[model samples]
Target: MTTIKLHNTKTRKREDFNPIDDKNVRMYVCGPTVYDRAHLGNARPVIVFDVLNRLLRHVYGEDHVTYVRNFTDVDDKINARAAESGRSIGDITAETTQWFLDDMAAVGALEPDHMPRATAYILQMVEMIEGLIAKGHAYAADEHVLFAVESYKEYGALSGRSIDDMIAGARVEVAPYKRNPMDFVLWKPSDDATPGWDSPWGRGRPGWHIECSAMADELLWKEPLRQDRLSEGAKSQPHVFDIHGGGLDLQFPHHEDEIAQSCCANGTDEMARYWLHNEMLQVEGKKMSKSLGNFFTVRDLLDQGVPGEVIRFVMLSTHYRKPMDWTEKKRDEAEKTLRKWLDLTRDLQPSDPTTFAPDQKLLDAVADDLNTHLALTYLNALTAQPQKLLDHARWLGFLGDKARQDDEKARSAYTTSMGSGASDALASLANRLDELRQTAMQSKDFSQVDAFKTALLAAGVEVRMSKTGVDLQPASNFDLAKLDALK
Candidate 1:
């Protein structure tokens, strides 16, 4: 059995992962705040962490791994969306969240073991707030209760930001009721028009960060265990779980506050043994935003006929902790790579009795903190040898009988529509692109190479350049005459 090591955000170092029971490994990933359609930026964490979850299930038994990803159903953003759409908050959240789930499923992200909603856990949130008040970690203001930042001495440990710095950086409005600038709201009184629940403090709603802490404790740690009659004298358990993961953007006040709240309420030093944060995704090396006109929703990409698998592959190509720049060229390259793998395994016998012999070095790379980039290097090595590539693609969840069938149908339709001479023209263009790309590489003129590749793609040829060399294919249903006219 391979030992899995992960970079623990809490300790700021890489550490060997050892589950509490060695039989039941529990992980929690912060999920989407579903107020709008999920963007391509949002897809990174879903696919990257999903792969990690798959790797865990592979290492441990499937039933032994429990993964929880929560949905933030009750948030200010949801309320604002509800108002904008002229729908109830519940309706908006439910509809958008369903869309999010569908998009994630399309990208091959497995449904979590539990998808706890903030609205469903109101009672738990209330209980936690009451506990915090009783413990003197929180206090009530006029119709609201705020967590006392001063009470938690280790408040800055997780984010490495001093309380003063946090106060300065905080975008939160300073309500007159808050005791300190750095203090955050646990419960804020709700108006008649807004969503609310009757709590000890007042009729209010849970704060955004509080929902995750409460839900995680309730669903993961505090749930009762009812054993079957076969196991006499079986005891309920409260053993520590393993990991918590989210985007790097959450490393600040969000995760820091969660750690403070959960540890203080539970009276434990560690809320999560390991904390993992995947880096953000950028569009053309700029932050993705609608105002910037670079933002792209996952649905938008889907509507453009980009396969969900190709999207997933592009997300996983970069290291999880490294920022990835999304570009059409990258997507085209990933599509070509997938097409090659698909073509290699298209005619292979289903029961060919191929051994599941993945390169041990590749496995080691993945296990050493889920280095997907290195794993892809190994994948490219396999692709260099077509026979070996078909066998190895199984490890990537790509080149099985099912994958072959699916790709063959898609590929045949794609190729037949391109006419007789189109394939040969595409092949010639690919060869030219490779030669030009190589010259660019030798001259270290990557910009020109990128432009040349884009030109080929514009002319209805897809090209992938990697360490192993260049691989190319005709675009799906490409119209060579139309392409030539456009060029």
Candidate 2:
């Protein structure tokens, strides 16, 4: 068995992963809050944990690994969007949820075993909040149930911050009723205008932190192995999941509050054994912001005709712990590499991941703290063996028979409309692009190559370059007449 190692944010160390039950490996990554389209930043944890899920399934049989990613359907953002758009909250949530699904699928993320909607788990969340109040871990004040952060001595353990520090640095809701400055809401009352469910406290909605804790308990945790079976040592069953992951930004209040709520409510010492947090993402070397004119949703990139595979490649090119900078130059290089890999393995067919043996080094790279960047390096090394490359790419969710079929359909359409001459023209342009690059390489100047690249792009050609050479692929918007300028 390949031993897996992961960096645990809670412990702040890279440690060997030992699942409590080898037959079942469970992971929960926080999913999108479906108020709007999932932006590029939202895709980082999705891809990071998607890779982790794949690795888990590869190790523990596909059926044994259960991955849960939830949808935060009920949020202030959703309510505001509904109000601003003058649409019903339910309708907006449903539409945004589907959009999130479609956008993630384009980026090659697998649907998790359980994609629980926060609204669907409201009852469970309510029950958990009630339990917290009963246990003196929470209290109801001002029609809101707030977790007593001071009640849990280890409240800031996961984030490594003292209560005083958090109180000073935190953007705490300045509520007159909160017992302490750092106390967080477990449930809050909702007016007739806001989405609410009847509960022991009042007509209220679950706070963000309680939703995930309850959902994980329902979906991932085993039901205490039946009381009768506990005599056989089942009482020692793990309290929660093997791994919990999200962006670093969540590490402070959201995750810390979850730890306090779950541990205090359940009488357990831990919530998740390993906590993994991926770093934030940037665009064009600066924070992605609408003010910066760099804000882009995943759908926006897809609409720009950047393939999901290329986006994923650019994402995984950097380690999860390192802040990823999304740059056009990197996108171009990633597209170029994928073009070569797809072309190299075009004749081959994708198969079941189990049917083909992945390169040992590739597997090793993945196991070593999910060194995905190193794994990509290993994937790059497998180019000479098309069969090996195609199978491995399929295992990684890149190239598959469906992708080929789609390409073939496009190729067929092109051949039918443009005739056979179009094929020769593309090859000629590819050769021309390569000749320009080779001459520029010797001259220590890439002015001509950049000029040709710009023109080819204008004509809807996706230019790819590797040490082997340049590969020119016609994009969906290819214009045959525009190539005459380059000629």
Candidate 3:
């Protein structure tokens, strides 16, 4: 078994991953709010965790891993969008949820084993809140139930902040209630117009932090659906799952509150064994925001004909722990590289099924706290083994069925524009041009090289000459007839 290591945000160190039940490895990542389209920054954690999920499936058997990402359908943002757009909350959430799934699928993310909606799990949230109140960890005041932060001794352990610092530095809701300033809401009353369900605290909805805690407990740990897989001890208290993950922006308040609620309610030392968080993203070296004029959604890029694989590749080139900068230069470079790799492996067949496995070097790179940039560097050196390269790239969520079909169509069109032997002829011409350039470099004379380059340009071929070699490809306005003179 490969010893997978991950950086735990709770401990702030990289450690070996030891699952509570290796036969049933579990993970939960915080998902989208589903109020609108997911912007470019939103795609970072999706891609980062997608890669980690793939690795988990590879290390453990595919069926052994259980991944759950929740959908926050019952958020204030959804309510506001509904009122502003003159649409029902249900209609808005449904449409926005589908949009999120489509955009995420475009980037080659596999759907998690469970996608629990917060609305569907309201009963569980209510039950958890009741338990918290019973245990004196929470109290009902002013038609709302708030978690008493003072009751939990290790309230700020996850975020490493003192309650005084949190109160001073973070936003604290100063309601005239009998509680500490850092106390958070577990359930708030909702009016008849708002989306609400029947709760002990009147008609209301669950707060954002408690939603994840309840849903994660139900789906990942204590669900009756997976009771058969549980041990006698696990069945008693299954609150501490293997991994919990989200973005760095969510490290404070959101995740901290979840930790406090889950631990205090379930009577556990920790909510999860390992916590992972991917850093935020930027656009062109600046923060991505609408005010910065660099903000765009994933769907926007897809509509502009940017291949999903290109987006995935550019994202993976940066380490997940570091801030990723999206730039046009990086996008173009990634596209060019994927094009070359796809063309190289076009004629190759899939590796034998019995012997099928990802390259050891690449797997090792990713296993080291998801060093995707290094894994990609290892992939670039696997061209000599085309089948291995193709298989490994696919394993990393590249070169899917669509990409292969698109590459085939592109190659076929280029072949038809020239002749049946056009590919071979172009290769021969590229070699010939390279020889001329090498001779010119040695003799300090470039008459032949310059003339060949000019002729190739006139024929609508993009001639790229470098120290590496010469590469020739048809441009949009390629004229096969003009190339006849050079042939």
- Candidate achieving the largest lDDT: 3
Best by TM-score: 3
How far out, in Å, is residue 417 in model 2? 3.7
TM-score of each: 0.84, 0.89, 0.90
Tens-digit per-residue lDDT, 1-487, candidate 2:
9899989888889999998667777788899899899999999999989999988988888877878999999999999999999999999989999999988888888889889999988988988888898999899998999999989999899999999999888788899999898889889999989999999889989888999899888777644432332223323754566899999999988889888988988899999989999999999899999998999999999898788988999999999999999999999888778777877887776666565667778888888887989988888888888778888877776875556666778767977998867678878988888888888889989998888888988897877788988777777668989987776
Model 2 TM-score relative to the real fold: 0.89
| CA error at residue 245 for candidate 1, angstroms | 0.6
Q: Which lDDT tens digits does candidate 1 get at residues 323-359?
A: 9888888898887777767765566643343435456
lDDT of 1 at 69: 93
> What is the Cα-based lDDT of residue 342 in candidate 3?
82
RMSD of 1: 5.8
Model 3 per-residue lDDT tens digits across residues 1-487: 7889999989999999988877788899999999999998888888999999999988888878999998999989999998899999999889989999999888889999999899999999999999999999999999999999999999888889999999989878899875898999999999887999999889999889999999988888777767778667566656888999999999899999999999988999999999999998999999999998999999999998788889999999999999999999998778777876786788887665335688678888999999999999988998778877888888898888788887678767878766766667678889999999989989999999999998987786777766789899875346777877887
**What's the CA error at residue 428 for candidate 2, in Å?**
6.8
User: Model 2: which ten-residue window has the lowest total lDDT?
Assistant: 225-234
lDDT of 2: 0.85
